[model samples]
Target: MRKLTAGLFHSIDGVVEAPNLFQFDSFDDDLGALLTGVLGRVDTVLMGRVGYEQWAGYWPNAQVDDDFASFINGVPKHVASDTLTAPLAWQNAQLIEGELLAFVKKLKQAEGGEISAMGGISLVRQLLFAGLLDELTLMTHPVIAGTGRHLFEPGDPTTRLTLVDSQQTAKGNVVSTYARRD
Candidate 1:
């Protein structure tokens, strides 16, 4: 079964929105290696409509002779959007049909390496709450944003997660990996 993993860039105070507003230190080789390793494990990219639109508009034009650009542009992108349709403007992008939960469940059962979801907090919350996420990885920066949209919504049920691994990047970002406790 393919594992559904949520990889998010979060601020110190748990803000997952508008990552560009957060203070990002220099991306040294350590951070590069870390991101490369994370991207290497996933065969598919999952995202919501808004994130898909943003990424589709940007990544198609940002391609370079690099692993990230190549992987992002070349890999299959499954967008969970009720409004979007294909042929999607971005290469290899497809709109997910039927019920979202059912689609994700079927995707997990399919033969694949791993599925990764990034950004689009609403979709991430839905996947996490539906118990479809097998792993959650947060690359948390050191500075506090004080106010913004948080990763966990208010009134969410308590879900225990077991920490699988953690490492600090040279830029002081903490990369923490967690597995959902069944």
Candidate 2:
């Protein structure tokens, strides 16, 4: 079965909304290497409506030549959205059919490389709560984002996660991997 994993740029205070605002200084060679390794294992990408729209608008027309742009544009993307229609504008992107959890479960059963859920707090929360997410790696920066949406909020159901791996970058970013405890 293909493993479903998620990697988010998180803050020390658990903010996962917009890492671009706070993660610039903490981005180092080690962090870049870690993200590259994650991309190496992922053959498919999953995104929520907001992330899909944001990335579709940028990555397709991005003038810069980079590994991320190439990989994201070339890899197959499954978008979960209730409002978006068929014939997605971005290359290799398609609207997901049927229920989100059901589709993901079926996809996991198929033969493929690792599946990555990228840049969607709501989507990641759904997958994590439904027990569909296999691994979650948070690249936690050393800053406190006093305001913004967070990955985990108050009153959420208790979910146990086991720390499987952890490393720190020279710039003080802590990259930690957690597996859902069953």
Return the TM-score for candidate 2, rounded to 2 decimals: 0.98
Instruction: Assess each prediction's global lDDT (C-alpha) against the native.
Output: 0.85, 0.93
Candidate 2 pairs with clashing backbones: none
Runs in model 2 deviating more than 4 A are none
Best by TM-score: 2
- Tens digit per residue, CA lDDT, model 1, 36-142: 88788989989899998887888778848867778899999889888987778888988888898999998899998889986478998898878898888888888
lDDT for residue 47 in candidate 2, whole number 0-100: 96
Q: Residue 65 error for model 2, in Å?
A: 2.3
Q: Which 10 residues in a row give candidate 1 its minimum summed lDDT?
A: 23-32
TM-score for each prediction? 0.94, 0.98
RMSD of each: 1.4, 0.8
Over 45-102, each residue of candidate 2 has an lDDT whose tens digit, in order, gives 9999999999998898876578899899999999999999998999999999999999
